[model samples]
Target: MAVAAIAGGTFAFKALDKSVKLVVDGKTQSVSTYASNVEGVLKDANVKVVKRDDLTPKLTAAVADGGTIVLNRARPLAIDIDGVHSKKWVTAYTVEEALSQLGIDGGADVSASRSQRLPLKGASLEVTTPKTVAINVDGQAISVVSTGATVKDVLDAQSISLVEGDFTTPAVDTPVTSGMQVDVTRVRTTTTQEAQPVPYSTSEQPDGTMNKGDKKVVTKGVAGEQVVTYTVTTTNGVVSAKTQVSAQVTVAPVNEVVNVGTKEAPVAAAPAPSGSGAGSSGGGSNAGAIPSSGGLNWPALAQCESSGNPKAVSPAGYMGLYQFDQRTWNANGGSGSPLDASAAQQTAIAQNLYNARGISPWPSCGPKLLS
Candidate 1:
């Protein structure tokens, strides 16, 4: 009865022991045992906790009633760093610790998984470590160590400054290559003033009292002065770019004004009847009424040509006292038809013709005018 009682007492002690919850790699289970510590609980559950495995409520901590314990079993982590592949067990669940364990500084670029926690089974890491590169900027060669992706990224890593209107050869966004030559041309702007000439303009005004088709200049035109501002850009100590910024007139130009006539001409007096009336009433009265000008006898000439009838028209289309054609009359200042002119006006035009060319215009009657 004593031995049976002791066995029953041991069973009661085990039954009254603490109960602990275990979560392993996201799987949950309840465990009840007479365990005093985390190691005891793990041993009772028959779980192997290696040095690289993550265990919570550490192996030395005491087990409590209704307490939960978590364990994430880590796996082999394979990483390629500096062109070398290495394999190891990492207890840390995050990739950052994995990189640190591989003796890699934070100056390298890891695949996005670097920031994420380790997978349940295992993980692979790819790292692009910084390397030396040579670049040319503004004809100057430079050396730098970088893990950037493009030419622009390399420049940004070196703390380079770029402003508006600046450019580079081979383009900045192009992918970076080993020993690539990049030429950066620095651009600077400068303003300058230039003297330029402004051309003058001419305008005309109408004049009614003067002869039609006649023009006269009233004012002369003069050219003005202007100043032009230009923005000049120089690249690599060379002047090759220019742009006009503004233009200001320094002197106003004067426009020339001309007067154009639009008035109608007066009508000519009609010629007298052709006969002894060739000299007009001033020459019509007597046979001796010969009016002489420039030492020429006009009456004798007119008597021979028209016989005193000044308004007569010859079969040859000639008219007036001097037997003048329409062409000759107009050329001598008579308007319209010669017969449309007064005898006095015809005689005056004849006198002008005689004065300018002597009695030669009379032809067969010229000798008589000189007589």
Candidate 2:
């Protein structure tokens, strides 16, 4: 009985010592044996902790019974995702496992290695990874963007717009990867009036009878215009650059002016007939008298042509009341060289007779001669 009591007492002492209560986060838990540390206890309870998570009582600290020990694990992970800040917590044993457990994919920009071992107590891990994408705007190639998750995310990062008629190198819906390119081209129309100075030119009338100062219409003055299409590149809703892709002329210009006249005079008229002349019927009143009915000034003509000297002889070999040359006097049917009044009157009568018959050598000046 003594041996049995001693063994039972020893077993009871050991059992009491092993059965200790642990206080964690205000919750009490009973353990039958000593564990390595709080981290081991949390692992046994299937509680997951990440490097970014808050924790109390470090993993390296020893556990004490009834000491109100807090089994808080640390799980801290800092992620730089396309210039964005992000954090995650995981109880995974490796970087790859941690990301997977946190619903992160292999395509994500993760800085740490997938097979990299981590501390059991959890430590802060920096993931400096970036998703690469190609960008093209308005037919211009841009450098690959390093950090973006979705198409919209990539555009937002680059401040690019996705509008209708805009083209993309890689469709906007395409997934982003390393060195992937995305292009955007927007369609635009521009209207412009281009005024070209048309040089003036002179034109003649249709009638062929034009003079030096006369002018006519060559081209009417009309305004010219053109319409063009362009592809513009924009960033942050502002136009960055533009390129003309197509153009067309909408209107053409015409020129305009007034006209002036420049012409020479026509010929003169012939002398009147003797019998049909404007004179009195009586021979005594009209035979030796100048006609007064015609608009011609006989006195002025006599003074200018013969200088009141019907018998005068010019040094140029001309004679008679009109100073006619020998050839002209003969052509006009003058009887002889008229050096006196009577001879001049007779010669003038003969010339007038020939002029009335339309047999004179001079061109008829009826159009331009003054009465």
Candidate 3:
């Protein structure tokens, strides 16, 4: 009786034991378990399963002999799309498989090649779909159909090079999109040396022989020469900014000496007017005949003020040869617009203003006369 009970117990044990195939991430192994269900069989085999893991059969399914249990382990996949970032868990073995399982389109731009296998700890990916874009650069418009992830990639695909000080609109790292307009500014820098005139100084000496308003030039002024080095920056063939780097004097300036009269002239009595009323408009009539006087360089002042253009008008409302504003023109015995007058009239009026204000009106160009 003891031998029969031991034999029956051994038969029952053998009947309950089941042999099945277990596959973990496509790697197959034979498993032997006496457990009744799929969950119990995996536990008996020491297989750890999570919610994200893919199992071939339901955990509650009854375990039978010769059954196959497949478990596909899941891993994290980090993704960035069109600047938006996210993480997803997948049970795929390759980049193509992951993308396919995620329902991502095959034509999208991917950071990794599709056939590349995922690492043990999974991998990261960036994707950008095909887009139509327009780029304006170097005086030309380019239309492109591309699958670049960023604006920089698009530029790189076109063999575009960005040097120092060059830049692009929307930035290089900005994500690309359909119908986007990109502007590329090519900055070119150049160094140039120019000879500029250095202004000379004027000195005055008193002369008692002549009348108060009378003056004479004792020594004429000569401008010095200087080489000015400039850093010129241009964008797309147009000058954007110019900076002076250095200046070296090549020639010393010659100072001007003038003899200014100190004697007070006697005031003449009023001339008797003829019945015809002659010389009523003496100042206006002698416009073209006015000579350069007062010890100052009148021609230089005119040239500097308006580039010798008598009909020049400034954007700031300053008009005529000397760039005089309307208020200053009217205050200095000038009637009507300075533009309406002749070149000789403009010169005569500028001279009259200089006599009254002593070069205060032409503040910017006044120093140019010394040069």
Error of 3 at 336 (Å): 19
lDDT of 1 by residue, 1-371 (tens): 99999999999997769899998765698888789899998898998897778899899998888989999787788876644687878765678877786677788888756668887578888776776767666667899888766678788998776677677776888766656666777788899999998888889899986544446678988889999999999886688899999999999888899887676434333323344333333333222223344445655666666664555565666676687877788887778876666555666678657645777787677788778
Q: Which stretches of candidate 2 lie over 4 Å from their true place?
A: 1-30, 33-97, 100-129, 138-141, 145-147, 162-165, 196-371
lDDT of 3 by residue, 196-259 (tens): 9999999999999854545668899999999999999998989999999999999989999988
User: For model 2, how does the per-residue alpha-carbon lDDT over 1-371 read when each residue is reduced to its tens digit?
Assistant: 99999999999776544333555433568765445566665665556655655456766666555433444334556655444577665555567777777665566655566777666445555443466566766656667545465566678777778666565656666656667766576754333333333344444344234332233344554555666666665653567767877666656444444343344212222222222111112111111232211233332333334443444455565553344566665554555665534523533443343334432321232221133
Candidate 3 C-alpha error for residue 293, in Å? 19
Query: How high is the CA lDDT of each candidate model?
Result: 0.72, 0.49, 0.77
Choose 1 or 3, whichever is better by TM-score. 3
Q: Which pairs clash in the backbone of model 3? A: none
Which candidate, 1 or 3, has the higher lDDT?
Answer: 3
Would you list the rank order by TM-score, best first? 3, 1, 2
Name the 10 consecutive residues with the lowest summed lDDT in model 3: 277-286
| Worst 10 contiguous positions by lDDT, candidate 1 | 281-290
After superposition on all C-alphas, the RMSD of every candidate to the true structure, in Å, is 16.6, 18.7, 14.6
